[model samples]
Structures are given as structure tokens and as C-alpha cells.
Target chain A: MKHNFGAGPCILPQEVFKQASHGVLNFNNTGLSILEISHRAPEFVAVMDEAISLVKELLNVPEGYSVLFLQGGASLQFAMTAYNLLPEDKKAVFLETGVWAKKAFAEANLIGNAEVIASSKDKNYSYIPKDYTVNADSAYFHCTSNNTIYGTQMHSFPQTPVGKVCDMSSDIFSRVINVADFDLIYAGAQKNIGPAGATVVIVKDEILGKSGRKIPSMLDYQKQIDAVSMYNTPPVFSVYTAMLNLRWLKAKGGVAEIEKENNEKAKALYAEIDRNPLFKGTAAVEDRSKMSVCFVMENPDLEKPFLKFAEEKGCVGIKGHRSVGGFRASLYNALPITSVHALVEAMQEFAEKNV
Target chain B: MKHNFGAGPCILPQEVFKQASHGVLNFNNTGLSILEISHRAPEFVAVMDEAISLVKELLNVPEGYSVLFLQGGASLQFAMTAYNLLPEDKKAVFLETGVWAKKAFAEANLIGNAEVIASSKDKNYSYIPKDYTVNADSAYFHCTSNNTIYGTQMHSFPQTPVGKVCDMSSDIFSRVINVADFDLIYAGAQKNIGPAGATVVIVKDEILGKSGRKIPSMLDYQKQIDAVSMYNTPPVFSVYTAMLNLRWLKAKGGVAEIEKENNEKAKALYAEIDRNPLFKGTAAVEDRSKMSVCFVMENPDLEKPFLKFAEEKGCVGIKGHRSVGGFRASLYNALPITSVHALVEAMQEFAEKNV
Candidate 1:
């Protein structure tokens, strides 16, 4: 079997894929493909409802927060967070983490005044910036919880005076966090949730309607939540498959259990990276992400050769992003520990060849 | 055995569903689910490219026009159209024919000066408003090509003094149209295109980059086109399935052929509605949608029984919209003429009982 280690829109449990594939043919045996069913139909509506409810249950979302399944990935969320939460006169504060973080800040600044209080870009974002303080006057404190490119993750969020907004796109369900800790947590469903279409947003009800801008109905969080996340015909199959995937997650004992698996997967891969003579981890040891385990061969010229070696062993998508220039094995929740073991073995076999 | 007449996220070719289902489990036999592949991966990039190329070919989209597969459906396009086209000072005019038209004009007005140059709301949208002059000073004139709620359509578009924009949400790809006639033509894929998660936007390149407002990247057509519609991670399966559906359309001899079939389906059903003594057509005869055929019973109390009757005979989703208070049988492209014949037979049977 091919071990898929591609970043976001990566691996999902095979059972979920089977169910989703079956759904595309005959959903709920209604003799209708999920792709063709009306969102208003009771069958699909129940799927949407379950998708939303599962997010709340899986995260233990508190009473005052609302969970939304929306279109437009984290890219759109970058601007939407500013439009709904940042007023014309307000300054939105940000932690500059990686390319996504930079883009998030740039988009927010395009709509309103956005300031970066701290950055790890000086060292190619190998670690999280921890020294600077968020301004109390800022509209909101925005941060990217995980940098997929550099494989850095903020293990703990900073407490801020204003609202806290985090883009948890790459690492959302891999670990558990207190829902009430942040004012908003948005994740593109691709990585840990389900697929690439639906984006999951959990927001505190009270933080909305404060932007004072006449936001479009599609971009306004309050209106979307008011419509009960059926704001527009949501990504139907995405939501349905997401529900199926979440059901799988629930059956596998939710985030805590998945987090344990994710840790072991990352530990096994990183341990090999550290122990192997030809390789080394890329990110700062403390801030390295559990979701995306990025590393490089010590001998730069050997990188391409090792990539081919890994591919021959059916270790797919092990090549690193161009920006990072090494390797990124995304240990997402759905990737089995066996895949990590396989990657580790390949690395060991390759190291023996080189040494 | 089932005839689906649901307005949107409606019927698509059964073979397309089969292919789409296969793609989900083992996309191109890559041993990976379609949901797990990276949008940037070569295999998926090919899928995205083919999806765009198919739109251009099927629509005969000339040079200087960009075809985009975007998320957020037509609702977001309502605002995006104005955001990218309507200047702060210039007015955007609209022909308000139905609820969708009214919402489109309303959304445009929210961003800039907008006016409804004509409206059919006075008659409960029973007809398309034909008499109105679009101001030469208006930035662009917008119209809904098909009204799903009221079952009204603009068979022939108005020649506007300025740029012409159309929301062809419900009836795109059912018939052929000159892409040069409109500056922008957008449709939610659910009805006739593919599925709910993706929207198709065909825009003339010359009409862009003049709005003067700093539109956000996701809503800005120029930016999206520049990015080749990969502005964000697209709705993967929706676009993939859309490609398959479009391929089906092409193999069935393209839009001209489908238009003939669509015309025949509308003709057969409308003839039955007019001939049946117990029922009558809802929209004006000249303006009745060839896609959504709406009719009401002569005796209103029998509506529920007729719906029940239709469903019992394996005719599904024939229930009309709440506001219309009648039956709306949407004859989207994927719906076979045989299904129409089946529905007509049911209507005839129901009329005999009522009489």
C-alpha cells in the first residue's frame, strides 16, 4: 500500500473513504447520490446537522460558541476574520509564523490596520516567537497554530486582552484544546477534519457584530451562524464525508486518542531522523510540529537520491516543500503508525547505504 | 425508477456518479482517495486543468475570457460581482425577476449605488419584466438567467449600454449562449453544472481591473483569474465530478444537443400542464422557464395530495417552493426526457383522479 504523507488534503481513514465512495453512488440507500441530493432534503440535512454537532462534541465546545461549516478555505478565513472582527480604525495584531501567517497578516492589513507584534522569520521560522506582547488596543490577536511548510507549531496559545483568533487549519483535531480559550478557531477540513471543501469555524457568539462594518452576508459570521451554518448551500458532499470521517474519529475515541497516536507517529519518525547519521530535523526542537515532521539530509546533495529511495519503497509524498527544501512527512491523524514505521525503516535503510 | 425534480444539487448523469464514486476510492488507481490528494499534485492539477479546459470548450468561451471554478456558490457571487465591478460612485442596475434576482440586487446595493431598473415582484414574479431602460452611466447591468424559485427565465438577454453580467445559476450548460454577450456569467454548479460546492464564473478579461476598490483576493475576479482559479484549495470532488459531468455533456453532442432535449422536455411537460383541466401554469407563457416548470392546481387544496401522488409514482422533489405555492418540476440537463415523460404520466393520472 502507498503511504501518503502529503500535507493538507492528505490521508484519511480508509473506511471513511469507502463510505464516502459509497455515498457518491447511493446515499443512505435513498437511490440518490449525495452529490445530487438537495441540501434541504432531510437526509442531507441530517448529515449537515450531525457534522456540526460532532464538531461541538469532539471539541467540547461551550454553550456560548457556535460551530460553522463554510466554503472558502483558510485563505478566505484570513480576510473574513478581519472583515467581521476588525473595524476601520482598529489594529489587528498578529504573530508572524510562516508563509500562511504572513499571508494572513497581509490580508488582514489590506482590509484594516494589522500589526505584527512578533516574528520567527529571522531564522526561516524554525521556531515560534515568544517574546513580544500583543497590544490591548488591537481588534484581535491572530495567530497560525501550525506552519505546514516549516513544521512549527504553537503548542500553547498566548492569552490576550482582545479577542483571540487562531487558524488551526493544519493541526486542529490532532490534539485537544479548551474551546473557551480562544474567541475563534478556524480550520480548513482538509488536514485533520475530512477534505478540502468545507472549513470548520468555532466562534464565541458575543464577539460578533462588533466589527461595525456592513459585511456581506457570506462573509459575516453572525449572519452565517444565525442561518445555522446553512447560510448558503454548504459543500454538501464535503460536509457529508466530513461527518463520516468525524464519526470514524469518534469511534476511534476522539481527539485525545488521536493525539496519542499522532505523538507516537511523530516520535518514531523524529527519533529516526535524530538517530540516523545522514539526517537532521529542520525546525527548532521544542517548537517542531507533531502534525508535520520536517527534516533534511545532512549532505544536501543526497536529498534527491534519498527522496527517490523513499519513493521506491512506496513512501509517497515524502519530498519537502520547495520553500523548506528537505522533507515534510505530515503525520496527520489518519496516517497509521505503520506508515511512520515504514518511513523510518526506509530512512534507516538509506542511512546504511550512504554511511 | 426514481424521477428527481429537486431544484438544486439535483440530478446528474448516473454514469458520472459511478465514475465519481470510483475516483473517491482509488483516484486514477494511485492507491489514494481523491479526497487525500494535494490540490498542487500533478494528478489533481491535471484534473483542475481539464475541468477548466472543458468549460472553455463546451461554452465556446472566446479569448479574453477566464473560466473559474470557485467556492461559496452564487450567494457569494452576488456580493463579489458588485465588489469587483461596481465602483464607489457608479450605480449597478439589475432586473429583479424573482427572489434570487431581488437578493442579487440587494447585495449589490449593499456595496455601492444599486438600482432595480425593472422588477416582476409586483405580480409575485409570475412573469419576466420586459420594459426598462438600463442607464448608460451604470457600471454594469445584472440579471438572473433563470429563477429557480419562481420558475421564470430570461430566454433572451437584454442588450445593455454598459457591461452585461448574468447569474446563470440554474440553467447554465443546459443551452448554448454567446460568451461575448456578457461581461461576467456566473452559475452555482448544483443545478445544471455539477454540485453545490463549486461555482462557475466566466468573465471577459477586459471588463476587470476598473472597480477601483481594493477588493479582497477571494472576491476579486482579476486576482482569482491571475491565479488560474487556484487562489485557494478548491472544492476537490465537486470540480472533479463537474469535469466528469461536462465530459458526459460533450460526449452527448454538447450544449446544442442538450438544448434540443431540454426544449423537448419543457415542451412535453408544459403541454401537459396546459392540457390538464385540474391544473394550470404559474409563470407567464412567454417567460416560463424551460428548466424549472412550475404549475399550480386549479383547486389549491389538492396541492398536497398531488405532491403525495407524484411521489407515490416515483416522481421525487416535485414540491414547489413555499412562496410560489405550487409544484416546481426542475428539468435540469442530467434529468432524462424519460423522467419528464414519467412525471407527465403521473400528472395525467392525477388530473383524471381530480376530475
Candidate 2:
């Protein structure tokens, strides 16, 4: 079996793939491919409903929030969060951690007054900024919960009086979080949810429709909620397969259980990075992502060799982002502990060879 | 044996379904699911490239135009087209044909000065409005190439002085069109492309980046082209499956061949609708859609029975849109003429019983 560690649009449970594959052929034995099923049809509607429900059940989503399945990925969410929540007069505050967080701020800045209160850019986003205070008069406090590129994650969110909006695109649903902690949480479904096309937004009902800007209906959170995510035809197969993935997540005892498993996987790989003589962890130890484990070889020259060495051992997609050149093994919810073990063994073997 | 006539997120070739299903489990023998592959991966990049190439090849899109596969169905395009193309000062005129046309106008109107220059709404949008001259000074002239709800297709586009934009969501690949005639053509891929998640836009490069509004990156067509539809992660499975569907279209001798089959399918059904004493065509006779064929029983009371009768004969998704109140058998490119024959046979058998 190939160990897929390619970051977001990464691995899901094997069963989800099998189940989703079956759906593309014959969804629920309707004798119609999920690819062909009408979004308005009862069967597909049920899939959308259940997918939303699974999100609620899995996350213990609070009642005051609206859950949405939308398109255009987290990049669109960056613009939408600003359009739907940031007001004309008030400035939006951001703790810029990485590229995604910066993009989130940039979009908001384009629409209205938005400023970065804290940034880790000087250190190449190796650590999450911890000492930023969101202005009480701000429109919202925006942050990226996990930085997929740098492998840094906000272990705890900054407490803010203003609305809290977080782009949890890389690490959502990998662990449990209190749903009431943030006013808005948007995640690209490519990571932990299901696939690339659908993005999930959990927005507190009260925070939307407050932006004075005339938002497009597609970008308006309130409109999407009112239509119950059917404002337009949702990404059908993406949502359907996402439902199957969520169902699998639910069956695996939801976020808490998955979180525990995730902890073990991250722990195993990070331990090897620390213990192995040839490798070193890249992110700030405290802020290192549980989902995307980033690391580098002690000698830069050995990086390519290790990557090739690891791939030969079936530990693929371990090549790190060019910005942080070495390796990144994304231990998403579906990536098994066995894959982690395999990666750890590769690291150990590579270290011995290099020595 | 199932005849899927459901409107978009509608039917695709059965072989496309099988290939897509196989890709889901193990894409290209890469030991990675298509659902899991990174959009940045060379494998998926090739899929995206081939998809764009196939669109150009099939449609004979000119060199100056960029073909983009994007997310957020046509509804998003309703907003995006206006946001991208309509300038702050000039009015965008429209020939409103159906509900979709009205929506396209509404979204454009929200962004700037957009008005309906002509409309077929007075006749319940049963015909395409023919006698309208677009102002040379207008920002753009927009039209819906095919009105899915009312079962009307534009047999000939209006010769316009301004930039011509068309939403060909229902009838894009079903007919041959001179691509050079329109400045931009956008279609939600659900109908004739592949699935619900992706929307296709063939846009002239010169027309974009002139709106003078600070368009959001996701909504900005120029930004999308600069990034080549990889501005963000596109719907991976949708684009891949669309590529497969397009490959199938090319294999079946491309759009020219499909249009002939589409014509024959429409002819057989419309003829039966006219000949059967219990039924009547809903759209204006000359403006009938080759893709979506809507018809009603002469006795409204017999509608329910006829629907059941057709479904029993495996002519599923034939129920008409609520606005039309009859039956709509969408004969998309992938829908075989055999399925159309089966639907016609069911209609004939039902007519015999009613008599």
C-alpha cells in the first residue's frame, strides 16, 4: 500500500475511498452514479443534510452557529469572512502566523481597515505569535489555527472580545475544540473533512450580516445559511464523499478518539525527528503541528537523499515545502499509525546510512 | 437501463462514471486516490491541464482566450461575471430569457448598473427574445444561451456591438458555437461538462482586469488566468471526471457529432409530444431546447400518473421543474439517443392508456 503524505487533499480512510468509489458508480444502489445525481433530488439532499449533521455531531457544534458546505476553498473563505463580517468603519485585527493568515488579513484589508497585530514572518513563520491582543473595537479577530506550509499551529486561540474568525483549513476536525470558542471557523475540506472542492464554515449566527458591505449572495454567509447550503448547487460528489468520510469519522468515535490517535501518530514521528542524529524539527517545538509534521536534515545536502531513501521505503510525500526543505509527513485523521511507524523507520534507517 | 434526465449535476457518460470511480480508489495506478492527490501534484496538474486543453480542442477556443476550470457553480458566476466585466460607470444590458437570466441580471445589477434590455418573462420565458439591439456604449451584453427551467434555447445570438457574455450552463457542449462571437462564456459543468463542483469559463484575455473595482482574487478572472485555474485548489474529482467526460466526447467524435445526436434526440421527443393527443409542448415551438425537453399532459390531472408511468419504465428524473409543472427530460451529451427512445416509448405507451 502506498503511504500518501501529500498535504491537504491528503489521505482519507481506505474505506471512505472504497465507499466514495462505489458512490461514483452506484450511489446507495440508486443505480445512478453520484456524479450524475441531481443536487435537488431527494437522495442527494439527504446526503447534504447528513453531511452537515455529521459535522455537527462530530464537532459538538453549538446551536447558535450555522454550518455550511461551500465552494472556492479556503482562499474564497478568506475573502468571504471579510465581506460577510468585517464592517466598513471598524478595523479587523489579525495575528498573522503564516501565508494563509496573511492572505486572510490581505483580503480583509482590501475590503476595509484590517491590520496585523502580531506576525511570525521574521522567523519565516516557524512559530505561532502568542502575544497579540485583538482590539475590542475591531470587526473581528482573524487567525489561522494551523499553518500547513510552515507546520505551526495555534495550540490555543487568543482571547478576544471582538468576533473571532479562524481559518482552520489544515488542522480542523483532527482534534476537538469547543465550538463556542470562535465566532467563525472556516476550513478547506481537503484536509481532514473529505476533499478539495468543499469548504466548511461554522459561523455564529449573530456575527453575520453585520458587515456594511454589499456582499454577493454566493459570498454572504447569511444567504448560504438561509438556503441551507443549497443557495446554488453544492459540490455534489465532494459533499457526498465528505459525508461518507464524516460517517467514517463518526464511527471511529468522532473527534476525541481521532484526536487521541492523531496525537500518537504525531508523537511517534516527532520523537524520531528529535532522536535521529541526521534530522531536526523545523517548527517551534510547542507550536509544531499535530497534523503536518515538518522537519529537516541536519545537513542540507542529505535532504534529497533522505527524501529518496524514505520514498523507497514507501514513505512518500515526505518532501517538505521548498521554504522549509527536508520533509513533512502530514499525519491527518485518516493516516494510520502504521504509516507513522513506517515513516519513523525510514528516518532511523536514513540516519544510520548517513552516519 | 436507468435513464437519468435530472437537470444538472445531471447525467454523464456511463463509462465516465466507471473511470472516475476507479480513479477515486487508485488514480492512474499512482496508489493514491484522486480525492487524496494534491492539486499541486504533477499527476493532478496534468489532469487539470488536459481538462483545459480538451475544452479548447472541443470548442475551438482561440489563442487569446484562456480556459479555466473553477468552483462555485454558475450561481457564483452570476455574481463574478458582473464583478469582473462590468465597469463602475457603464451599464451591462441583458436579454432576460428565464429564471437563470433574471438571476444573472440581478447579481450584475447588485455590482453595477445592469438592466434587462429584453425579456421573455411575459410569455413565462417560453421563448428566446429575438428583437433586441445591444447598445454600443453598454459595458457588456449578456444572454442565457439556453434556459433550463423554461426549455428554451437561443437558436441564434444577437449581433452586439459590446462585449457579449453568455451563460450556456444547460446547452454548452450540446451544440456547436462560434467561440469567437462571445467575449466570455461560463457554464456550470453539471449539465454537459462533468459534475456539480466545477464551472467552466472560456474568457477573452482582453476583456478582464478592466472593471476598475478591487475584485477579490477568487472572483477576479484575470487573477484566475494568471494562476491558470490553480489560483486555488479546484474541485479535484470534478475536474478529473470532467476531463474524462471530455475525453469521451472527443472519442465519440467531439461536439459536432454530439450535436447531431442531440438534435435527433430532441426531434423524436418533441415530435411525440406534438403527436400524442394527451400531451403538449411547453416552450415556444421554434425555440425548444435540444437538451431539456419539457412537456405536459393535456389534462393536468393525468400528470402524476404519467410521471409514475415513466419512472416505472426507468425514465427517471423526468419530472418537470415546479415552474413548468409537467415533465423535463434533459437530453445532455452523455445521454444516449437510446435513452431518449426509451423515454419516447414510455410517453407513447402512457398516451395509449390515457386514450
Candidate 3:
């Protein structure tokens, strides 16, 4: 009955969890934990192949794109993309929307020069910036698709003159998008996909080998592609769970159908925040994330009691991030509409009791 | 009845896998996929704390040593260790034993000046080199504790005038060792531990912050130690499985007991290979790895049928590395004596048939 709103590593379908749990005991009836199997073994290779293939199909990736399941999460990709793509003395453009974008920029700056094309940081990143021009000569333009902490999202993606890479860690597979527009897209699996160990990276095959730098094998996309994501030992259990989750998504009519349900869930919760006198939404209306809804109380002292009341009513993980205090109800792909409805009801009860 | 002898992502104790399976579905009865829990949440933080604490106890790690569970496997550590510890002006000493050692040297050479003080490659790395001298002012000395491809091991660790680091990727936790001998040690979890995504790094705190070179946050040992491995989203499921495996290791008596079993298994298998006229052990007796036993036929043409025959007799993953063709039997902590007996019997039958 409890609603999970904790962001990234947040929530997953019950059926996906069940199937993944069984994989740890016996994967493909091999009588071995998926963790115990070799990544190169035909049995595990089949699992890896299907996971990558399904992601391409589910996301409707273009023909030239190759999907890679890598370790080190999105944080590592921030450095890897910059190291592998940025030309020796040139730069890359970045849109600093929130924590993730800032991190990407920071890494790019450390490895090579990078310009901040636009930034919403001046206003505490409550909205995504607009009307920024990407330099055609730059290596690639990078931006975060969804900000987990501030509950802000890029409602419309930027048109990059250069190649485009999106850190879709929080909102991947939640909606259908033109995969061909992006040169590279990377997402940590904990949020909308499956688990913490794996990060899904889809890259256009032709976009590689441009940077003259001798990129380390682990960070090099070409090396990863050549080895079939088996250049080294992979996060086997995490990858298997991701496959299970993708299967669940396919069963539920893929991303297009899931997007509708997600939109409705966000609307129900956002409507309650708007209607209630005691709470106020945090992010800009147009830029607010459908995945994570951040809101603060009109009466600051009521925050603790409101959280307590919500917890008592079986709504959990509603406390906002410490940096931006209030409440954040993360409505991810797996969060049921019933959970969003329950949160709305709790908000109504709290407003009635307080005001 | 099947024996799994794959080098890594290898066998794990059945009990560990069983317990880990349950946690994936409902971690600690919290109705959350272990994959879905935030690394900073109390539930997962507790898991991380326990895993680190258990590793400390089981390894008898000193107070000054900090244990960190990281991503990118041992491959990433090759570059990270050099970047973090190797000073700009001085060369780090490396002992080239096999494929992994060569990889470490290549990465180090790319980052800074590196010296290969000794090499076994002249003999195709069939033996570990001896009578090598360590530089007095070298940044650090690096060696692979066990060679996965050639099945050779450093029977006794090197005594260096400077700090020492060992890439114990394939042989860590198989036996007790003097922790004081090395300033840092790293191992991929897939082999002797639980799974692949997590890498265990134990560092002596005093040896850090010396390099003055700017290390990316992910590669900095101090940054990870400061955050207690929560600097970024961790491989939660993998670490949890490692904890389960560690718990199993403790329940059956720690590394000391596991070492005894490992030794016995290796001895039985090697005896069969040595006594059989048709087969020949690959590595020199003095340098042979207790974990991985590499062998091939006196005549190379019999390799294919020998592998097929072994596989048919319920022995899996016994194929040798392409670099060194023949067969490899990886006897890790979780690999029981019975499996080794099964492999030994299969080898005996194959030898009789070939003769």
C-alpha cells in the first residue's frame, strides 16, 4: 500500500522484480545465478543481446545506432563523452539545467574546454533555459533531459548544430521520442529502467573515432561496440533485471501507451498541489518534470506534520531533497496511478485539517 | 551436476545466491526492489556499511585502510591507480606477468612514464619472473596477484622500497595475506566475490593526496572514501550480492577455511593433469595459480574434442583463453571439491581415450 517517491533507484514493476529475483537463483534454467555466469557465455550473451535489441525496438532507435549496457552510471559518461568526443583544442557546448547538467559541464571542463551555452542555475534551476545557439564546430552539445533534484525537465529538446547527447537518466523510456535526432543518449538504469549497476548508452555508429585522443578502452565507445559490451565483466544481474523491465514495458504496449498513463498520474498530483491552499508547486509550470513533482508548503511549520500525516496514510518518500526542502512525489514509470491518487487525497486531508 | 569453471563471473555459493534472490524482490520487507532503493537511504546505507565492515573484518584490514566499492571493474582501476598515485615526473614500476599486467602497463604508459622492472612474456608468461629489483624512489610498484590467462601467480608478494599495489582481480579472498605488504589492493567482484559490476579497492589512507594531479571525482580514492562510496549511485544489487557472499564466507569460516578448500581442489585437478601422459600443465609449477589451472594436450589437435568431451560430461566453461589455447579450470572459493573431482575424472577419461 505504500507509495515510493524516492528518486532514482525509485520504483519498478512488481512483475519485473519477481522475474529478476528468479534470475539470481536460476537464469534461463541454467541453475546458476545470473551473477555467476560469464558475460561471454552463450547463455549470458543471449540475455545481453536481447536486452540491447529490445531497448532499440522499445525506443525505436534508428538503424545506425548501437546500444551499449555499461557500468559506472551517468556520472562516468559525463567524463567519457567529453574525453572521447571533444576535439583536442576545441570545445563542447553544454546546457546547465540542473545537478546532472552541471556535473556534465564540470567533467567536460576538467578534461577539455566547454562553454555553457545557457544556464537556468541563476534561478536555482527551476526551469530549463531556451534560445541557446549551438556552435556547429563544437564537438557535441550535451544536456540533461530530466533533473531529478529540482523536478525540472526540458519540455522541448534543443536543436543542436553539432551532434547531440542527452543524459536521460531520469526520464528515458517514459515517452516516445525521435531517437534519430540524438547522436548519443545515455541513461542510468535505476530510474525509469531497472537498477543501479547498468547505464544504457545508444550511439550512432558513424559518430565515433573523431577524437584524436587515445581514449581508454573502458571509456571508448568503439571498443565497447567491438567487444559487444563484453570488453570486460558486466553487471550481469542488473542487465538481466533491465531486460525483464523492458519486457514488462513491451507487454504494457510500449512507451507510447506508458506515456499516457504517466501524464495522467502527474496531472492528478499536480492538480492537487494547485488546488490546495497549503502547498505550492516549486518548478516553472511548463518546465516541471512529470517524473518528479516538487512542491513546498505555504506555511513552513506544517512541513513536518504534513510529512508525518502522509507517512501515516501510507504515502512515503514524499520529503523533498535537503537542498530544496519541501515535498517531492516522484511519479516514475512504475508508480501506479492509484499511488498518485492516494497522495492527492492525503494533500486534501492535510489542507482541510490545517486550514 | 554441472561444473562451472569460467575464469570470472564464475561460480558462487548456492546459499548466497538463494538469499540474494529474496532481497531483489523485497529488500528487508520494505516492499522495494533492491534496485529501486536509493544508495543514501538508511536501508541501503546500512547494507553498504555492513558490506564494508564485513570486508574489513574478513580481510583483517588495518584501521588506516579504507575499503571502497567502485564501478568500471579492474580495467578502470588500471588507469585510476596510475592517475591517482603516479606522480607526473617519476615512473611507476610494473611487473609484466600476463595479459592483465600488460593492460595495466599500457594504461600507465598512456598516462605517465612506466618501467617494466621484470617480464615473464619472454617465455609466453608461463612462469613468474624472479630476482627483480624495485626502484627506491618509484611512485609505486604494481603486480597482478594472479594471472587469469596464463594461470600463474605471485606465490609471495613483492617487497618494494616504495608503496605497492596489487591487481588481485582473479585471486582475491582465496587466501589470507599480510595486508601490510601493500599500500593498495583492488579486485573485481565477479571472481572470488559475488558479481561483476563492483570492484573492491582497499587503500591505505596515508598514501593518498600525494599525486597533486587533478583526478576526476570517480577516480579519486579520497573522494570515494569521504563519501563512503555514495559519491555517485553505486551498483547496489551487485554490492548486496557481494555482502551475501561475504556472509556465506564468514558462516563457513573466513578466508582461512576457504583457502584450504581451494588448495585441495587445485591439487586434485593438477595431479590428474600431471599424471596423465596425454595432457601437460601450462604454467611453471612454482608460479602456478591455485585459483586457475591452465593445461593443454601434448598435441594441439586434440584440444577441440577434449573440450567437447569435457562439456558432455557436465563440465562447463573449461575452454582456455584464445591467447593460450587448451583448457583452464578456475577453482575459486565457491567451487567445491566435488566439481574439481568431476573435472579431474573427465580429464582422466579423455587422456585414456586419446592415448
Candidate 1 lDDT, B94-176, residue by residue in tens: 99999888889888999888999899988999899888998899999999999888888888998888989999999999899
Off by over 4 Å in 3: B299-302, B349-355
Clashing pairs in 1: none
**1 or 3: which has the higher DockQ?**
1
Q: Considering the two chains of model 1, state its CAPRI-style docking category.
A: high
Query: What TM-score does each prediction get for chain A alone?
Result: 0.99, 0.99, 0.98
lDDT of each: 0.92, 0.90, 0.89
Query: What is the TM-score of candidate 2?
Result: 0.99
Native contact recovery (fnat) for each candidate is: 0.79, 0.85, 0.74
**CAPRI accuracy category, model 2:** high
Please give the clash total of every predicted structure, in order.
Answer: 0, 0, 1
DockQ winner between 1 and 2, please give it.
Answer: 2
CAPRI-wise, candidate 3 is medium
**Which stretch of 10 consecutive residues in model 2 chain B shows the poorest summed lDDT?**
B346-355
Q: Which 10-residue span in candidate 3 chain B carries the lowest summed lDDT? A: B211-220
TM-score of chain A of 2: 0.99
DockQ for the candidate 1 complex?
0.85
lDDT of candidate model 1 versus the reference: 0.92
Better-scoring candidate (lDDT), 1 or 3? 1
